[model samples]
Target: DAGVTQSPTHLIKTRGQQVTLRCSPISGHKSVSWYQQVLGQGPQFIFQYYEKEERGRGNFPDRFSARQFPNYSSELNVNALLLGDSALYLCASSPLGGTRTGELFFGEGSRLTVL
Candidate 1:
């Protein structure tokens, strides 16, 4: 009955460092997606996973990657971080086939700060 959960609510790293963010989806949900949100801007889709497979990906650079587990939990990893990469990393979950209104349940998000 819980909503999606993300770990390490905040993070700080220097440029060129790598970081990994974690997410656990809602129970019974089969789809998980990642997004990046910068201050004063909307979230940008990064990656989507369904049934443990990559379903869709946005126009992010190759440094961003994600994977879903058998239990529907997922992780997002970013390599060679840049100051421009600092943002709120969000994880969202939805039922398979998507919602009638096409909405997603999102986690509080992991805040990444790159210097």
Candidate 2:
């Protein structure tokens, strides 16, 4: 019955370091997506996985990657991080094949600060 869960609520890293954020989808959900939200701006979609397969990807650079497990949990990895990459990493989950209502449930998100 949980909505969604993300780990390491916060993180701080230096430029060029790599980081990985994790997420667990809601019960009965089979699709998970990642987003990046910079302060004062709307979230930007990063990646989406359904049934453990990559369904979609946004305009992010090659440094961003993600994968979904069989259990519907997912992880977002960023390589060669830059200060520009500092932002809130959000995880969202929806029903498999999506919902007609076009609603997505999101988690508290992981805040990453790159220096």
Off by over 4 Å in 2: 98-101
* Model 2 lDDT per residue over 1-115, tens place: 6679999899999999999999999998889989999999999999889899988899999999999998989999999999999999999998855423247899999999999
For candidate 2, the per-residue lDDT at 20 reads 94
The lDDT values for all models are 0.92, 0.91
User: On residues 72-114, what C-alpha lDDT tens digit does candidate 1 reach at each position?
Assistant: 9999999999999999999999886442325799999999999
Clashing pairs counted in every model: 0, 0
Pick the lDDT winner.
1
For model 2 the local lDDT of residue 40 reads: 99
- Local lDDT at 18 for model 1: 94
